[model samples]
Target: MLKRLWLILGPVFCAALLVALLLVFFPTKLRHDFEAEKRSAVTLTAASFKGRMQKVQALTDANHRFVPFFGSSEWLRFDSMHPSVLAEKYDRPYRPYLLGQRGAASLNQYFGMQQMLPELENQTVVYVVSPQWFTKTGYDASAFQQYFNSDQLTSFLTQQEGDAAAHHAAERLLQLYPNIAMADIVKKVADGTALSASEDQFVGLMARINKRQDIFFSSLIPSYNRHYDQRVLPELSRLPDEFSYQELEKVAIEEAKEHTKSNDLGIDDKFYKKRLKAKLRELKGAQKNLSYIKSPEYNDLQLVLNQFAKSKANVLFVIPPVNEKWMAYTGLREDMYQQTVEKIKYQLESQGFTNIADFSKDGGKPYFMQDTIHMGWLGWLEFDKVVDPFVSNPKPAPAYHLNSAFFSKEWANYDGDVKEFGNK
Candidate 1:
């Protein structure tokens, strides 16, 4: 009786263990769900940003045209005139897929691009270059670690040929997150050395494990942001049946006026009440000496340009401005800010990236900014004017001529009057 019972239970336990192991270790092949991708396209949550399935499917969808809107906290400023809302309300030819949130800077975007290289290839994309990201110290490591995508890291490390860009990226990754995950693999990659047979096998195994985890757990990712975007539907109803710039302008100014009345600073009422009301005075002249002229962020941005050139993506670069009142209160020097903008423009135009919508000098325009750094109702309208036409119609393909020197420390720290970049 004991032997018979043991035989039956042993097989059952063995079968259960096998199933569990397969569930955790086996790779999953995800299929396309176009309808589901509509929501995923607008879902700007970090989980969505870090994962590849949702983004790749939405980007490569045969039916819908989802253009990537890469920026930081500005994407979360969901007003009626926002690109997502305007596009949805107007029934435009393309939909904007937001890719960043607070704390997502240049380096964050560079690594995040690794997994979706195929999707980004030949894609028409927009990147909002924030002046604040050009701080002397550059990207904040703690913030970087919070949105870290291990899959992208694996892709970057394993596919590298010990090239200059790869070496720089690996070194930065190791330095940024001292206690970063997969330090052994990252350190080896940073050394610009070849991986051993066992290590190579281990990296591949980890990649599989990461993919398995993403597959089973992806459904649990939040859709709250997508839902939040749907609130624009009511606002969309308020628009005319036909598109009219005059009508939209009236709406934008009225909306901005109603929302920004609480502060003479042109900041949104709720934001001012919550974030600035307490320390309003203490922040005066706080940025008197703060500068954007020199930082390693320039090097990190080169990684993005390098990737785009390789992809041959037709790209649009947006330069956002600080609120004039806020800029004055903070005492940030205009000359210094202009120098940074000039440097940023030099980097882009020098690389043949010329489709730019520059609002860097429009900070003084009333109601253009929602707060200190983000675009409000009027600003988004101005953004739509340029962006809608670009994405709606076809254009000449990008003629990017990339320079590796932009990845060097000299360019990162160079404070010269950069009228032109040496595209050598």
Candidate 2:
């Protein structure tokens, strides 16, 4: 009986040992390269997935003057050459390193900041924050994984002790995706071991497969950017060049000309009105439970604040302006939103963050925004007026405030059109 048992268990033990050896020793060369094959086939162009950081790295490798400007898709319209415009306007050297991505929450931004901080300490950095980031869910890990590597995730996770928000984020991450190879991360954290190169590569491969369905046939696809040559020229980065400037101006003119003629873009005034009404209806009961203090987002926000405080980097936090109609529709009264913003401001102030510019209640004038949230060309100009000065001085700016009465009033057919902007 003992001999028979040994015969059966011996092969199983050896097989397990052999597999472990393979995983530890030859993970890369032995395993099939699914992610690379998939990437070589098809790639997504969401702000987070796009090659913005890679492009920024290429630019920064050549130009050391660029300072990272972190934000969401809301700031995507901000021209790369705007720094030159700022330099001219403020009569001070200005170079902004824009790294905005779609659906990026504060956690994602914080990670991006960490990646840049090694090279950019004590430099003036601009962060454009959206109020919506303070919601309960905070950030989606799957979305974040597209841009951030596993090493970043591991670092955050390993250093996340005593942080309720970070703990909760990890829990949420694990709960959302059960088979995330987190056990390996946890083991590494326990052993004070960094993930090996092959291990890191495996984690990355798993993330891409899980998030983007890279194993499937639909992964290999191609997309194009029109006027690629025009964009690549270094002259486009200068204000005097007038190439990008004219292109954007022409786009604004064309957009204005076709404004009244609505099609399937769903950016018309009526469409927004309808959506606003529906959102107002949906958020009626939900607003009661909403508080920035209790949000998981605030927890991650606290972590970010702590990091900035430690770095003592010159940072300017710009609160992007929100559309009044959208705010009202979302059941956020000026007073209520103001209270929330005040809490945020207080938190920042407590952390010794002096420079905060809240454009939250700018009333979302037609010329300021193309849709309910996204700023248009003229909208960016108005924002630049505020940002350009802040970037030049790197000092505290007065928060733009709106009276409580502004929110109480009802808006009717507020088409955000500015003839002045069009003529420019």
lDDT of each: 0.82, 0.49
lDDT measured at residue 410 in model 1 versus the true structure, 0 to 100: 85
Error of 1 at 61 (Å): 1.3
lDDT by residue for model 1 (1-424), tens: 9899879898998998986686586656656665566567677778887787777767877777888888898987877888877887777888888889798988888888887888888888899999889889888888888888778777776666677778788889988888877887778777877889998888887776666666556756653444445655667766666888899888888888889888799899999999999999999999999999999999888888888888888889999999988999999998999889989989999889999999998999988999998997889989989988888885655788888888888899898867534632
TM-score of each: 0.91, 0.57
Candidate 2 lDDT, tens digit per residue, 1-424?
9899989998999998875554444322112232222221112234323332332232244223455566776544433333333443333444454566777766666655543444444556677766667655556667766665443454455344433334444554454344555666644543455667887676665544332322121222332332122332332443333334455555444554455244222244554556544564566445544543334555456556655654556677877665565455555556655655665665565445767877766655654555556665455655666666666676433332221111111111111222221232
Off by over 4 Å in 2: 1-64, 77-95, 145-147, 154-178, 182-184, 187-294, 329-331, 393-424
Whole-model lDDT, candidate 1? 0.82
Model 1 poorest ten-residue lDDT run: 222-231
Total clashes for model 2: 5
The backbone clash count of each candidate, in order, is 0, 5
Clashes of 1: 0
